[model samples]
Target: MPEHEDKRPLAERIAADIRKKIMSGDWVPGLKVPTNEDLRGLYGTSNVTIQRALQILKDERFLDGQAGVGVFVRGQGSQTIMPAHYIAPAGPGQPYRWLSEATKRQQRSKYRMLKVAEVVPPVEVARALGLEAKSTAMLRSRIGFLDDQPAELVHSYYPVELAQGNRLADRRLIPGGTPALLEELGYPTRSQDDVVSARPATTEEYEALEIPRDVPVLEIFRIVYSDNDKPIEVTMLTKPSHRFKMGYHLEAS
Candidate 1:
């Protein structure tokens, strides 16, 4: 075979094709997949090949099978997340925008505060927050859940000068998330820049998101700015790429 030839297993290739259709919205949620005979005919393969391909989709949660019935597309199709919706601070007595957004879609949402402490952040985060090499920053790590399933892992870092001796360093949950507290601390978020990328999940991410090894994770590195364009926060968000879609809307000036 040529160096550039497709070398993946036959079943995986078939599953990849089907997975692409599902992710591209060609196969909408709750739509029944074609019968085994239909699939075999379409691929000109054997029954075992079709079964193996279908099983792969089932494992990835793209399809669900019912005894004595056909397989249907899972209802929790890829969720499209609008970054703009999560940028604002929650209003008084209101839940965080992310939680509220999930509620609006009738999905239960919650967050688990995983860790809160002063620790040396990742090099990129350190640089973004203007911290000296090896300097410590306040780190707050959490996992966001939708309908009892882990949806995203978040690591947010704040400069020591800003978080020290403030509620930001507290281990407990903030009433309206960090943005509200930041605003109260006089660092109202003015704007933010986000860089998105896709990569294989790290060991910690794989365990946290409960995803298969084949699924990649999406990372959003965000730097939030305050007045005078000072960076107030640097956040890294990780989510299962196969289960989530990032949506952006830009208005013409």
Candidate 2:
């Protein structure tokens, strides 16, 4: 049964109503959202009920509360969640586009390339890439930003043999992203395998992602496959939990 049909907590039900309004543009970015008193009157409920509902949205990053001032709608950061569904096939000629769940909007993201050189792969990365221990691979490390806030950190590893004579070694954005470059190199990607896990943020992650110690980060690690089941590239991505949410579409049998 749908959540609305169930006798869920009153706060959750109220949260759903406010969430719908926020999503539908009745409340827009940078707008001052309704206060607890206003919501209480609107819902014909007590202040406590309204506060609880607003707390749910605040946790989801839909709203931000000021100490003395009223709550306000967050801009791009809070308003958008990356889409795990409606994504292009994890294949060639189809870039892994991340779209905003808020009206499917596209945020202008900037890629800040870090290390782009051959490096010894970490034990886990090497294992995932099918490389023997002590093997060297071309590593491209970068961080993505939305509205000048660090959003996702990615590291792409390619076998030295596969990266030779290619722009993969360059510190720049490939014209159409990594998949397109792989396709041009005669290794068209045919599939993708993803592994997701969460762990406490490291010191570097805390500073780099501007997240606190108490917050955990989500890791989306994936291996790209070429035709004939050849694993060509492995990418590790990390995103702060409070700033992003992952959505999944499942098909029931």
Candidate 3:
């Protein structure tokens, strides 16, 4: 009997399957992977192929190898991020919601400002901010870290009229994140719209996230509206798909 042909290389396909298991919680952290012989038999592939697949996982920080024991899943697997939990402004003198959540997970977190400038944003972002053609906005870009690992890339845009000479355009970290700052600026968020999607990583995203080409990026395009449904901000967040899980909770009315 012949096998179905898959466009991706055999090793990549196998690695992808193993990655899914790890991300799905089926392959729990610190669990030993099947032996090379077992994997080869299960996948109906050669030992070299199995080794290649395992190597891919190792390179992606999903697996760790011991000299004599075996390869085991990393202690901390993919992290789940709840969008709702971090959307609101923090209380007075409180850390940003994201940083607080990371603390609860026992992970060190911080964000490094990448660039703050007034520039023409992406078409979607520009449109979301209600900007006209060829108009520019204040852009604040940064890389968020968890446990010292680059976890997400964030690019937020604000209307120049609202951000010029403001902390949003300043080259520094805004305490309590932009949500709190916006509230202080008299634009308390009244609502938000989020659109999540997965796509191939762009070159900048690939380099920024330090992920391989096989890993796609998950994008969260969020538009925050103030009073009267006026869109005041647009934030785009990018994360490695395999390393993050989006979580949401709902209550029956």
Candidate 4:
């Protein structure tokens, strides 16, 4: 006989059950979630643990709770309206295969240029780029929509001398994409570093993505280096946790 393994933490297991229902479409968007007291009894847990379970789904954007109306499911079809970290194809002779959305998925996405200007870099960005504190860089900010859903907000920075008076300063998609454009101009991206984190959305980001203020975001800062090892581009991208997810595949070392 099985050892009757029930060692998983109560709150996590409770949250897992709710998460499954939402993901499996049994409780789809607008469907009400079980009440706190109901969940408490089902899992034989206290009010606090039950509340914690619900909070997990809320954080994941799988459930929305109205003060008086209780909690309801939120649809999960993010891929229908999201973009991948790498959004370009690998050219002939390229060593690595580019990971991007399918052609149909690409057609469903759109982007808007929000701003393009020269600004003194933030301290962290300045450090990343090895620039003086007062040095200015060309900043290009934009928002992307996938299937009419706001999917991401990105801000890219480059040395002003390299970006000014170029298409990178213009408010539109450049031909062959930015990486290709940069390569044609001799700053080919040879490698990049990415740092990922999550936190509550700021007011501006919350509004841009139309997500609740309490919703956390997956923020990634990518610093692209040229063949000469110069930091040529730094981009910060924010994706709503509820509206986006990421996956990675790696070969065994």
Candidate 5:
């Protein structure tokens, strides 16, 4: 069939054509996709149409482009989860149970520990955790995946006192996620205030996550407090903005 005979929307048709090639492994990860000129010639379309199609794929996290290095296929199938209701702790012995229920309802979810260390808390982090500056803290950074796809990078700070002598820090404690670990240490049932913003990725972040410069990221600040309203942890979550949607429900006071 003549490619020009395909009368579909230019961008959609282009994206569909490329997506098929990707799925068939014709273009592997790190392999450059057809250039704008290449695509234009193949589809008999303008550079603008090709650009739009490429942009769509980039937003979908299926392609990564370098300033002068060209665009490359980023593999296929990365899932993203939208933020939902902020689950509140019900009571003692109930928080973990409730969390399990909440997570089950999540449309998608995944996580990977990136870095874990014991270090002195920074001034801002200490203040958030209600501790003195220079106080020891357990810093854990993770890259969360959703449906087997990279989603967000999260850095969590916890007072060292909370993790002292706890086996939860051990990598072998796989099933016991961070929240569950806290619960085991008797700091369950917490509440969080989430603040969100959008910005471009820093050089370090871009390299670490292999994100393109044109992509903006969503930064989420989560301050968690115990049931008694004592701040126990602070988390910073950074995610590709285009891949996610943040949703919340507000009730009448």
Candidate 6:
């Protein structure tokens, strides 16, 4: 190959070359990429240029740098591109069932219903549930565990008309939980929309989930709707970001 001196910035050129190597499988997952020294010698560039190139790869989730260990390639197959703000879709069904299935299949956890009650909705919650302020509603909370380790916290709210006087609102109702209860009442679930984001956790959240303060939490806001387009429930789920990875497949719009 001819040594043509392209006018692009040194960092940009280095990043492009490294990307090509990855795409061509020259550097596979967990493989050590070229070090700063190696890059400096190969490209006849300064340390600054090499550092910038490495940073770019890291930001793209293609690489992870350990404190004492060198930078290693992160397999492309495990990469997540969603901004963590988009919600996952849940089909119509019992609210508890939808949550339980997601926890089992996606997060790999065992879910346990913590509490259920018939109570007046808070102002913000009432608005989301499309009910009058302070109107009665059903509230449910659950904790998910991965082999005894707490993994996620889930809180769900349902309209009083759909939840009150139902077996789902009974505190002693466990095991099959909400989904089964709803199905028994002839109100099978249909679909749900998930909204996710990342943020610092509150003290209560950190303690309840048993996570460190430095660990970021993934918050998912979900709205479960029925076949008639009626909002059945609104739920909030939280988990440690490092403990779980979110995935989605998209096509050209």
The most accurate candidate by TM-score is: 1
**TM-score, every prediction:** 0.96, 0.68, 0.95, 0.70, 0.62, 0.57
User: What are the lDDT scores of the predictions, listed in order?
Assistant: 0.92, 0.75, 0.92, 0.74, 0.69, 0.68
- Give the per-residue lDDT digits (tens) of candidate 4, residues 70-174: 988875534322223463424544321211343434536667789988899788888888898799988889887766778888899988777866788887766
Candidate 2 lDDT over residue span 1-253, tens digit each: 7755868778888988876667667878788987777888788888988888888878767789989988987774433343344223334444344412222454566678877999998888898778988999899998878767788788889988988888888887665566667777888877777788899888767878877435678898888888888888888888887666665566899
Cα lDDT tens digits, model 1, 1-253, are 7879988888889999999899999999999999999999999999999999999889888999999999999987888999999898999888788988999999999999999999989999999988889999899999999999899999999988999777888888898889988988999989999999999999999999998747899999999999999999999999999899999999999
Residue 119 error for model 5, in Å?
1.7
Better of 1 and 4 by TM-score: 1
Q: Taking the tens digit of each residue's C-alpha lDDT, what string does model 5 give over 90-129?
A: 3444433323543676635555667788877667777788
Q: How many backbone clashes does candidate 3 have?
A: 0
RMSD of each: 1.4, 7.0, 1.9, 7.1, 10.2, 8.8
What is the Å distance of residue 160 in model 5 from its true position? 0.8
- lDDT, candidate 4, equals 0.74
2 versus 4: better lDDT goes to: 2
Q: TM-score of predicted model 4? A: 0.70
Residue clash pairs of candidate 5? 110-145
lDDT of 5 at 19: 64
* Residue lDDT tens for model 3, 62-152: 9999999999999989988999988889989998999998999889999999999999999999899888999999999999999888999
Lowest-lDDT window of 10 residues in candidate 2?
A: 94-103
- What's each prediction's clash count? 0, 0, 0, 0, 1, 11
Q: Report the CA-based lDDT of candidate 6 relative to the real structure.
A: 0.68
Pairing residues by index, what is the TM-score of model 1?
0.96
